[model samples]
Target: MAAPGCFMEHIAFLEASDDPAATTVWKEHITDDESEGRTA
Candidate 1:
């Protein structure tokens, strides 16, 4: 795959839905956007 142009474009995918490790990352992301006054 081609490299992403921006730093935020970099992504590491976790396929398991119930995985505990990815939970906090996703929560942090959502909270960050909410704190910044943005939407999904």
Candidate 2:
């Protein structure tokens, strides 16, 4: 199981992220940004 604090951190990481290239790179493993696509 994951910790509550870790879950919140993950949410923040996803919310604050703005780099498409980086998002795409990270998406290679996690699909959170799949629908959004590149944000420029």
Candidate 3:
């Protein structure tokens, strides 16, 4: 697992990007991990 601060920074970077697809994919990946009881 990533350090919490690093994870948040990565998320912020993704959100700041112009690529919606990348952000959407990242969100979906996080959702899937959560559903499996895994930490992002």
Candidate 4:
């Protein structure tokens, strides 16, 4: 498992990236978690 800080950094990097693929990936990640009743 990734450390919490590293996971947060990855999320920050995804948010800062302008690439559409990155945005899609971020959206999918959030959606999956939300569906599982998890909060970001």
Candidate 5:
């Protein structure tokens, strides 16, 4: 329900994230150990 080309951006929040892409965090949360192959 917002205007076109305009939306709330959460980059500030994400930039402060411990897991920027939420990749590893989600993997660990779901008990998937495969994230060990990831490179930062």
Candidate 6:
């Protein structure tokens, strides 16, 4: 019913997060590599 559909939408939103923490970690790694004169 409508409740199940709403629940699925909520689950989808949670799963869709691009994970900012993970992105920040990746950017930091790239920055470190750049400082070391390496490519990302």
The lDDT of each candidate is 0.51, 0.43, 0.53, 0.50, 0.38, 0.40
* C-alpha lDDT (0 to 100) for residue 1 of candidate 2: 36
Kindly report which residue stretches of model 1 are placed more than 4 angstroms away from their true locations once superposed: 1-8, 18-40
lDDT for each residue of candidate 4 in 1-40, tens digit (9 for 90 to 100): 4443344325444356677684664333554456456766
State the weakest 10-residue window (summed lDDT) of model 1.
1-10
Error of 5 at 26 (Å): 15
Error of 3 at 36 (Å): 0.2
The segments of candidate 4 whose C-alpha lies over 4 angstroms from its true place after superposition are 1-30
Q: After superposition, how far is residue 20 of candidate 6 from its true place, in Å?
A: 29
Q: Model 4 Cα displacement at 18 (Å)?
A: 38
| Number of colliding residue pairs in each model | 0, 0, 0, 0, 0, 0
Tens-digit lDDT track of model 1 for 1-40: 3223433335676566786665646523434455455767
The digit string of per-residue lDDT tens for model 5 on 1-40 reads: 3334454332223355676566434322321232233343
- Which candidate leads the pack in TM-score? 1
Candidate 3 per-residue C-alpha lDDT over 1-40 given as tens digits, one digit per residue, 9 for 90 to 100: 5543344324444457687775665433455456446875
User: What TM-score does each of the candidates earn?
Assistant: 0.23, 0.18, 0.22, 0.22, 0.17, 0.22
Candidates ranked, most accurate by lDDT first: 3, 1, 4, 2, 6, 5
Clashes of 6: 0
RMSD of each: 8.9, 12.5, 7.5, 8.3, 14.2, 17.4
The candidate 6 region of ten consecutive residues with least summed lDDT is 4-13
Specify the poorest-scoring 10-residue window by lDDT in model 2.
4-13
